[model samples]
Target: MIQAAAAILKKEITQELRTKYALNTILAFTGATLLLILFTLRAHQMDPTPKSGLVWIIILFASMTGMTRSFVQEAEKKTWAFLQLHANATEVYLGKLIYNFLFLLLLHVFTFFFYLIMMDMAIQSHLYFMSAIIFGAASLASVTTLTSAMIAQADRKGALFSVLCIPLVVPLLLILTRVTRFALIEGAASGALNDLAALVGYCGVTITAGILLFDYIWND
Candidate 1:
């Protein structure tokens, strides 16, 4: 299972690099978002604290845009059957989750640089923030990948994916945003142990569910 999943992930990563897909789009959108925020806050006195949740909001939307494309190419080709034949359900789910997590993590790193420049926010502990971003984004990415898989089978996959996923992801988004806002506003005062715990728990549960349920969805 592990090997199979790794292979799928490698294939996904190769395709993403070959086509310059998710990362490019995510970076472009992220850049646009930073620009918009900068212009919007130009005349206003921006809060040095976590007063504005703009970063989290931008991340959530940008993540959604990036994640949606993760499965789009496979779905377009109706290649679910071929994937299943190559690997078991667990491998498929894990591979998707792995690639999705890596994809989002890259976006997080790129956006963090932009946030520092645009907001002039001090990320006091670089290592700590990077670690938090990685875990938090991985959690969100896993959930998004599972939801994207579910949507890949639907008729209006993109729209339906958003409708279903947005509501489900609100809690994660809220907690992550609050944590990010607090860190940006209060520095190291923000201890994200709770959020991290919840994210890990959620990832475990969702990955398990995705693995178990994928067969039914794919066969349907």
Candidate 2:
């Protein structure tokens, strides 16, 4: 299982390095969105609530753009059948999940840094805010990775991806936004524990569920 997963992960990383499809698309979209937000709100002061919400909003759409192609590319190139022949469902799913998680982590870090600089968003508790970002990215990656696999064979993958992901990710976004807002306020450490816990729990649940159900989704 480990070797199979590693092979798949290496294949994904190699393909991505060669083609740069997902990375280029995600970076371009993120840059355009950040520029729009910066120009649109240059004169106004955004409170923490709206600021935090906007950060996740950009992340949501950016992730949708990049991660939706996870399995769809395989299916489109007819390499999915090749993967199925060589790797078990669990191996494929785990490899994809790790790849997505790492990709999202990098994207989120880039987004957060630019968001802070472009939007002038300040943080009071850098530690807490970074924690929320980590768990939030994990949760998003887990859910979207599974959804990408499930919708690999769909005709309208982009539309269906958003339709399926939005409802599933609402709770995650809410928790992330709340925690991020808490992290922005001075001495608000006590309030973020619950939200952080919720984010962690959501990540755990989604990952476990994705692992358990991936075989069915893959083989279907």
Q: Which pairs of residues collide in candidate 2? A: none
For model 2, state the Cα shift of residue 58 in Å: 0.3
lDDT of 2 by residue, 3-105 (tens): 9999888988999999999999999999898888878765227665688778889899999999999999999999988988999999999899889988999
lDDT of 1 by residue, 1-220 (tens): 8889899999998888798867787788989878877787671257654433566677888888878766666778888678877887777778888888887787877877777776667765454466558767777777787788777756977788789788877877666665665456555554666655666676667667777887776666
Per TM-score, the best of the predicted structures is: 2
lDDT of 1 at 184: 60
Residue 33 displacement (Å), model 2: 0.5
Off by over 4 Å in 2: none
Best by lDDT: 2
Quote each prediction's TM-score: 0.87, 0.95
Every model: Cα RMSD to truth? 2.4, 1.4
Q: What is the C-alpha lDDT of each candidate?
A: 0.73, 0.88
Candidate 2 least-lDDT 10 residues: 40-49
